[model samples]
Target chain A: MDFLLHIIIMACLTLFPLLGYNIVFGKGKILHFGQEAQSLMAVYTLWVLVVQFQQPFLLALLASLLTTTMLSLLLAQLSFRLEPDGFGVMSIALHLAVLSIILNWQSVTRGALGIPRIPRGILPSSLERYALVVVLGAIAWYFFLRRLERSSFGRNLVALSEHEWHAESLGISRKKVHTIAFLLAGTGSMISAILFPPYIFLLSPLDYNFQHMIFFVMCAVAGGPGSLRGVTLAIFLIIFLREGLRFMGLPADILGPVQIMSFGLILFVAVCVRRDTLFPKQRTV
Target chain B: MPILSLANIGLTIQGHHILNGVSFDVEEGEVVGLIGPNGSGKTTLFNVLSGFLKPTEGSVTFREDDITHLIPSKRAQLGVGRVFQHFGIFREMTLEDNVRVALEAMPKELRNDMGTMEETVRATLEMATLLSHAKQKAGSLSGGQMRLLEIARTLKSGKELFLLDEPTAGVSPKMTHQVADIIGALKKEKKTVLIIEHDLPFIAQICDRVVVLDVGQVVLSGKPDEVKKSKELQEVYFGADPTT
Candidate 1:
């Protein structure tokens, strides 16, 4: 039961960030740099308020959301203004910037030492409670994303992805659409952040670095970038594989290497075998 | 009134002059054909008119407003619609969704209050004679169907000024007539159209007047018969005299 609960928690943790990034940057055939940074900032924001300021859960969540959103908007403006050849580069730069901030500002982040003993109300002692929390979180996220995808705004994002020039020609402002996509991504990351501390009982700079960025990207890629189901399945498979490998007597030191190798292999295979299925080309109208 | 005008427009890319001092005007309710050989700046002029490329010199005015520096979308907002040489229909989306997107992109005031996506899509498809394939993914459509889909989307935009680049380029001969019919429909609606066509017969059938371009300059502008008779125009298009 404990093992199952752990798997569920890990799955949700992995799935949320992958889905969040894919929801916005994924659509544009261009990735944005700030998604991972925004996620890390969200975690830090919540950690600071809940641990330092001793804020209530609801207030901390709200504050984290607001800060992350503002940061995302700022990053979008900066990243979009300068021409980065692709979203992958932008994401790497932003992730490094956040890492630098977290590392340098030891007072706020406690740096690599991490914030331990994170209080998990009601669910910390029981596997059942943890499972319930995971189920509830997944439901909330699924519905929220579904609502957005079905809305008028969602259609516009898909349009922008399909043909940004055509969308602009039709009078839809690219900047506004891109900003909205970033905001949605930020919101998803913040919600995930609030849920994360309770599961792991810690927040660290290592939690939001390039390694995790690649993990999230792999989940999105494996699941299929433009598809929700693909991303969800990818998150589950990746987490399952990681835990399975760890259980097979692999040392902690080699875990990161294993993850990188497996992710690369899977992504390469997926791209080569099912290029059309995984990353179906979109025509511009 | 002349809905759109281009004066002495010139465009150079990577040290190659693609369009040089080419100019023309399209009045409201007129369907003007821009005919030329391959690499004769017909499509380049369309690109400039649609605001996809900035002219190195001269100006573009629409509805008496100078829109020389306006971006593509801004020009689209002011009633400029462009159909590319390659069909630009979103392949992943359904035909209905494609038209709906165009309609939704229009300013709120311009959209029909009573029109749902299904209704707008159906209407546009009917106009283009493609109602049967409304639910099919646009990428799955044949070249002719894709062209029809593109024209349907343009019409759904409700824009008066249309820039169609090689509307029948890849389409079958049978589908060419269908495209011609759609252009006729645009004429009946009193829309201003600038068509770039290599098919002389297609241009001759629909165009009120034709402009011929060679090496990025307008070598002739007159009725189709008059332009067809020009020795230089024939030489530019056919490379030699038929008598020879």
Candidate 2:
């Protein structure tokens, strides 16, 4: 039962970033690739506040989320002038820059040694209760996103993503919508940043790298970028696949490559078989 | 005063003169057809009026206000709506959502005057003959239906000046008639329109005035019948010698 709860918690953790990516890239069409940067910023901010500054856990969580959101807004504004491909490339570059800073800034981030022994910060100690809380939170987030999809702001995002000039012609401010999307996505990822690291009792720059970024994007695409239910399912499937591989007798080195290969193959087939339904590309009329 | 006036509009990009000395005026409630051959700067002129492109030389006046340097969304807020040659309706959203987005994007005062959002969305879809498909994804709509949806959404957003770029392009004859009827309805509602069209007879059938452009210049402007009968229009469209 505890193991099942652990798997569920892991899926929930994965779901947070996928949901965040969905808001910006899937709906607003910003092509943001800075999820890892945002996550890392939030995690480190929380760690610095709680461990070094001796701030209260709850206060640190809020401050970290606030800091990440502000940085995301700034990043979004910087990338607003770029075309979609440029926007994506710029985000990746920024992510790598942030990663480098985290890795090299030894005095502040403690460098590659990482921060260990984090507190729970108002969360339930029992695994089952924590899983229940996370599951409930995920469910709430799913419904909130669904409601948002039907809201006026949501319509603006959809319109911008579908046809930018048309949306602008209708008085939908592309920059405003995209900036808000970035802010919302960053806040979404902050949940996992707050919960996941403490659950594992570690905050490491190595954990939030390009590979994890790619994993989140792959899960988002496989689930269908705009569909919350699809993303939820995709996360579980990918998580189960990874966890299942761990149960096998393969060596660690072999297991890593095999897992990545399986993800690529599954994503390729999903895209091929469900191309029309997966992302629902706007057909030019 | 004219509802829209373009005074000596010129646009040069990367040393290429796309438009030059293109001047015209559209009066209140008038449906003006801007007819020109391919590469004749009709769409570029529309882009300038819609605030998508800035004319390097001249100014655009809408309702006595100069909007030459306004951003597209600000221009939209000032009641300049454009229907693209390529349809602008959000295809991934439902038909209702396509309209709802346009309505909701408007300024609060304008949006409020339109009554409830639900009713407005329904009415807008109904105007486009698309109420039945309100819940359906707009991508499933035919090309003609999408054009009508875009025009109807624009109209319902309370735009005073409509810039329609080839509303009949890619539309069937039956849908063409429907588009014409929608423009006629806009005319009755006292909305001003500047339309770019390739179909001469369609222009004659609907437009009160015609402005013919060729190679970035306005070659002729008059009543539809007069412009249709003018020799310079023949020379511009057919490349016939004016003397002949």
Candidate 3:
């Protein structure tokens, strides 16, 4: 039961970035491949402020949110200036650049060794209470995204995704909508970054690598882009499925590869099965 | 002063001149027809006026504001609306939502002047005669109906200048008449329209004046009847000589 609770907590933690990604890439049609960088920067900023500068927890969290949002906005600006294909390549490049900085900034980040023993700020330190807070936050975030999807702004986003030039001719500013999307995407990761470091009691470079970025993208794609319910269900499904593999009696070294393989397999099947949903289209006769 | 002025517009892309020295003026409430041979740069001129493609030389002045280098969205905000030759309707959205999106995107002052959102959407759909299909996705709409929906949506989008590219293209005769009636109504409302079309009779029926293009240049411009009977137009459409 404790193990099951742990999986649930982790799944909810993962929802933060996934929901953020859906708003930008799924709804806005921005090929933002820098999800990993946003998440890494959020946590790193928090760590630098709380651990190194000795700031208040809330203050550090606010600063982390602002910093990450700025990073996302900068990336959005670059994405705007390039074609879709170029933007995709640029986002990946930016993600790698951020990873390189985190990996090599040994003096501040402590490099690959990572910072351990992160303190739980202002929240209940008990595992059960922390789980409750995280779970509640996830539920609220899901509804928040749903509300956003239904708002006038959200409707504008859907219209833009369907046909960008048409939406523009209606006076919808593509740049404005896309900028807000990146802001929200960054905020989603900030929530996770705030909750995650305290929960894991460590901030490691490995946690914010390209593999985790792919996990977020896979969840968004396999679950069905632009559907909050689909993405949320996918998060829980992938997390539980990964945990379920633990009882397979596989060796520890091989287990990690097997888990990633399962993700790819699930993604493949989901793409095949939900082709219509994966790509939003007009109904056919 | 004319509501829209295109002065010496020239667009050269990759060493190919799409539009050269294309100049015209559209006064307020004027429904001008832009007719040309298939590759005579009619659509390219519309693209430049709508800010889709920037002209290499010359300027676009709309309501006295020089918008030559402005982006498409900014042009839209300044009351320049375009109905594409290809349908621009958001197919996955409901008919009501299609109109609603445009209304919602209008400038705040204009949106406010137009009553509530729900009323505006209904009225816009009513203009297109698609109010009954307000709940239906626009993809379910027939081709002619889609054109009507897009035109109606643009009509109510608070735009002072409308650039319509082949509005009647691929539409049925009955739907084409309905489209003509909509343009008639737009003129009555004193809205400025520059329409690109191949349907000469339809253009003659609605347009007060016509501009003819041949090989990226305005070969003729005059009253519809005069343009229809011109030797240059005959030569442009058919290689027929004036003696024949």
**Could you tell me every candidate's TM-score relative to the true structure?**
0.91, 0.95, 0.97
The lDDT values for all models are 0.79, 0.86, 0.88
**Could you give candidate 2's per-residue lDDT for residues B1-244 as a string of tens digits?**
9999999999999999999988888999999999989999998898888888889999999999999999899999989999999898877788988888888888888977989989998989989998999999998999999999999999999999999999999999999999999999999999999899999999999999999999999989989999988888888888885567
Tens-place lDDT digits, model 2, residues A174-242: 878888888878877788887887788888887789988878777877877777788789899889888
Clashing pairs in 3: none
Q: How high is the lDDT of residue A242 in model 1? A: 77
Give Cα distance to truth, residue A282, candidate 1, Å.
Answer: 8.9
lDDT of candidate 1 at residue A112, scale 0 to 100: 86
Clashing residue pairs in candidate 2, if any? Answer: none
For model 1, residues B32-132, the per-residue Cα lDDT tens digits are 88988888888778778877789999999999999999978778878899887878777777777788878877867678563676788788888777788
True-structure RMSD for candidate 1: 2.8
> What's the distance in Å from true for residue B187, model 1?
0.5
What would the per-residue lDDT of candidate 3 be over residues A107-143, giving only the tens digit for each residue? Answer: 8888898888888868788778888999999999999
* Highest lDDT model number: 3
lDDT of 2 at A180: 80
Candidate 2 vs 3: which has more TM-score: 3
Ranking of candidates on lDDT, top first = 3, 2, 1
Candidate 2 ranges beyond 4 A from true positions: A274-285, B241-243
Positional deviation of B3 in candidate 2, in angstroms? 2.1
User: Per-residue error at A199 for model 1, in Å?
Assistant: 2.5
Which digits, one per residue and each the tens of the lDDT, describe model 1 over residues A1-285?
677678888888666666778886455545565577888888888877888778887788788888888887886786567664555576677779878988888887788887887887656456677768777888788778878776667777777777666666666677777787778788778767867777778887777777777677666767777677777888887888877787878778987688789888987876676566443354422
Best by TM-score: 3
